[model samples]
Target: MRSVFHGWWVVAAAFAVTFVGFGAAYTFSALFAPLQLEFAASRASVSAVFSIAGFLYFALGVVSGPLSDRWGARRLIVGGMIVLAAGLALAAAARSLTQVYVAYGLGVGLGVGLAYAPALGAVQRWFVARRGLASGLAVSGIGVGTLVLPPLAAALAQSVGWRGAYLVLAVLALVVGGGMALLVESDPARRGLTPDGAPPPASAPPPRGVALGEAVRTRRFAGLYAGCLVCGFGVFTPFAHLVPYALDHGIAPTRAALLLALIGAGSTAGRFLLGGLADRLGRLPALLSMFVGMAAAMGLWAAASDFAALAAFALAYGVFYGGWVALLPAVVADYFGGRAVSSIIGVLYTSVAFGTLVGPIAAGRAYDAAGSYLVPIVLAALANLAAAAIVAVTARAPTSSR
Candidate 1:
């Protein structure tokens, strides 16, 4: 048997870290009900925890991406694992809403922020030729993690309580995530091999990087950023609120949590399947398809008064939303080149942060005032539709819009 390439090991590390990091974060949806009961907090207010954590998660990428280039992914990931475990432990022990905010918002946010970019960036550096497949395969863990974690979390909440579940997650993060960190190589140079195990090209120097300043000024970047902002709003708000939303519709808690699992299952497929389509059809088209799908899913969610409709929403949203996540690295790599793919992705992801930060808070407010998710859900679908239009127009034409 041929020895597994070290690059695949790096992919393995990326997968494990993502599974733990994202799985823990996604549990916030299931955590919402318990937190509301304990804290007597309103939906919008309790959701601030997720909003703040997500904000810090995306915002800190600016620092972590550059640091990953200077230091190494392994160091960042190891450090992040420590921080993540501590944050989960801290959040678990909190007595008040403020403590929850500090622990999950700042602590968890900072830890996840530090790790995510470096992990994905390192994988991108390792697989130049198979960039899409490697990234999709690696990020598939996010979907799998999303799929498996929520139901287990719901079960734990019902049995041991949410705090115990959190402590268990803290242990899992430290053990599984930290051990995997050892296997990651921040750059392929450390393995004495070029990216994708390719031989060094003759005579030509490596391509120069696109400066962040130059990249932001481009029409393409502007459009992509705008689209991400909208997509983030549409996708993440539902992620944070889906379980509770289903519960509001009179669904059983476990079955409501299964809605999130369906998203994860569909996403796992999307990351791999649509990721390959991005290689063939172009990243913009793949993104367009998924964005449109997410918009329609949201519309279905708005009308969903029954289990079947909600389940359909979960499955559709999971596939498209997962496709969006998987395609991002390839899109950034293709547009910006690998010179600073992580940094570019990190910057582009600020739009995602913008979406995540605003979406849940806004949705919460809508829920609080109107006692229904109809407004925001419809708005989310509109945002996604607009995102699709933005990508189609800007990518096809050189100008900002058609």
Candidate 2:
């Protein structure tokens, strides 16, 4: 509880954790082929491993969020880092498919779930006036990590064995996540302020908190949740499948790798630019624009045949998608109230987990059936368009205390 003037430093720490932790998780796409060959597994079986990891990462967030609210961010994040490191290290030595699934799907999934909620929740507590910008800066670490890790992972897999890559990743996770945990704490109670930076009155009792059920029952809560679901589903397509799709399209592996890297770069820019903009345009408009822009980016990906077009699509899409992730949690807090923001946001985030589970599996299945990425990319574009439509139509109105 040191009195730091700039709470944004906390956000920067959160970003660093997310950049390494979640970034490594999303980079699994680059690991799929290596894993499949490593274990002599079929594509379907290999895909299931990552899908399970995605599901656990997302589904567990529902509980992790509430737990963070109850337990505080520091313990949860440190614990998650330990679990993530252990899981990755174990996976490096895994022999059976079941071992791999348990190491990755259970350990990594739970670790991410534990870490992600608290990271955002801590950042949410630290700022109010510039909530959008703060959240963007913190979450944009995922973008930075995504850009940096996947290609690095691909290279690691090529040079060192995949097992060695996992060992290196585990070490990276421990170093980054552990260091960031030192900077993370819970609410500003130690600093004598509510989330909005207002000093609590000397004699006034604390305000009543909202229950989870009551929060969910509100109209605004439902709207925000639906909007986030669409946000989750729409932006993930290009992210999850882009690397493989590029290689399939006869692009050089290095160029395909760069395309994914551009996405990470775009996401970092988007989180800052769009998030800062949200503080001005109002959060709802910012989110709505993200959905629309993401839909367009997905379409661009489906249509692009060359490196330039694909790179442009990644740049444009990554920016909006990154902003959407950063802003939505803050938006959840704004519309629903902050008392249960972590839990509410966690539940809302399940849609992304669901999308992550479905996107790669569905895309891979479609590719298997059709013998091409064309149909799957088109379908992903259509899904994004539909998500944009849903966001456009969802009602937004402020709700009073429940």
What Cα-based lDDT does every candidate model obtain?
0.83, 0.77
lDDT of 2 by residue, 1-402 (tens): 545544666787788788878777866767776787778876556666777778787788788899988988888888888898899999989998889999987778888888888788778876788899889989999899889988888788889977888888899889988778778877777766665566667854543346677777766666666655544543565655677777777887667777778889999998988888899889877877777777777778878888889899989888878877887887777766667777877887787787777766766677667776677666555665666556555544436534
Query: How far out, in Å, is residue 149 in model 1?
Result: 1.1
| Highest lDDT against the true fold, candidate | 1
Which stretches of model 1 miss by more than 4 angstroms? 202-204, 396-402
In model 1, what is the error at residue 202, expressed in angstroms?
5.9
Q: What is the lDDT of candidate 1?
A: 0.83
C-alpha TM-scores of all predictions: 0.95, 0.92
User: Local error of candidate 2 at 253, Å?
Assistant: 2.5
Q: Using TM-score as the measure, which candidate wins?
A: 1
Candidate 2, poorest ten consecutive residues by summed lDDT: 393-402
Instruction: For candidate 1, write residues 96-156 as lDDT tens digits.
Output: 9999999878867888888888888888877766777788888888899899988888899
Shift in Å, residue 287, candidate 2: 0.5
